[model samples]
Target: MQEAFSQTKNASAVKNNYDRVAWFYDPLSRIVFRNAQIQAQQALIPYIPEHANILIAGGGTGGILEAIADQYPAGLRITYVEISEKMIRKAEKRFTGKNTVTFVHSAIEDYAAKSHFDVVITAFLFDNFTQEKADRIFQKLDKLLQPDGKWLFTDFHIDKKSSRSWKTWLLKSMYLFFKFFSEVEASQLPDTTSLFKKAGYHAIFTAFWYRKFIHSSIYQKP
Candidate 1:
């Protein structure tokens, strides 16, 4: 499961760094990003279907499932996958009473599912990978989705041409600083729309927050 990431430059180092800093993740994340995730989540809510069987990859603290369970019906089944052991533990604690969500302490490539999912949601995870890895991830995602299923993703994007130049620079600077501590790469956010199209998924809907600081795109299989 980890071998692909291990061989990929900086992946293992980033995971190890996240493990070391797991305890302070949420607070630091909120502080540094300034509620960017909350804004993304708010923007993502309308994308979810009421009866969807969802697959969530890199669901660090599992808060998205909470948001889903809050807004969606009780029948929705969610499988949350995360690679960090510490993050998994924290998620377990946070989601203790939620019987509708299943937790997998493994990478998306490692987890085996009984059926293809109706919806795939990845929040804040795509920006951490290299382009090669991003390509592989989308390839794997193509195999996992059901026919006509939806793929929804929200993550950071470099907003150089946006009106708020200083804000974009600040976000980029913080991304680099966190990369040094987390060993994760801050650059190489491919317009996933291209990769998903190449993987045979059609663009269904797309939205961006603050021009690119946080962006969401949804694709569907024909």
Candidate 2:
């Protein structure tokens, strides 16, 4: 099937590229995005309930995990999945003795969940693919969450009407840069808000940063 082929191809691209960049991801991200990366993850932490089962798909370099451990040390169960083995290794090193976290070195499409989770966190992950591929992946992720669960999402967004022209240009430039260096498949950012709404999710909390060039939203399945 076309869907299966797309999944395989995308997974390959992600794994190959992320493996190459795993060692330098943290410093690069901090330099580029500064505190915005940490702020995005922190925006969702207050929404996560105690004793919750959480799925963190494409959680790069374990910054979010570090934040969670610092905030809620012992009561949550988390499954952290990443396509790059080296990236997962870095994450494991970050939390060497954490008991409630399980790291899975696998692509998002290949990760099979034994049970549905209460919360799913995806940070700067979905932008790597074309719109169609992102849509399919979002649908698959929707099925992996429990009914009434929350999905914490953070990524770049370009608002045509309210956002300035330079922001659009900058986003395009960023995409082109990533496409060349990171093997990213998408040339433009996908409309994640519309895709999530199509999957029967309603945004419970939304925040914007860097003049609305980036957005962090918490969507709940009702």
Clashing pairs in 1: none
Scored against the true structure, residue 129 in model 1 reaches a CA lDDT of 75
Candidate 1, 48-149: lDDT as tens digits? 776677888888876676666566646677777777766766776653234367777666655666678988888877777777777777778777888888
The TM-score of predicted model 1 comes to: 0.80
Q: What is the lDDT of candidate 1?
A: 0.68
**Model 2 agreement with the true structure over 44-143: per-residue lDDT tens digits:** 8889988889999988788888788777777788888887766777777674234377777677878877789999999988888788989888988899
Q: Local error of candidate 2 at 196, Å?
A: 1.8
Highest lDDT: which candidate?
A: 2
Residue pairs with clashing backbones, model 2: none
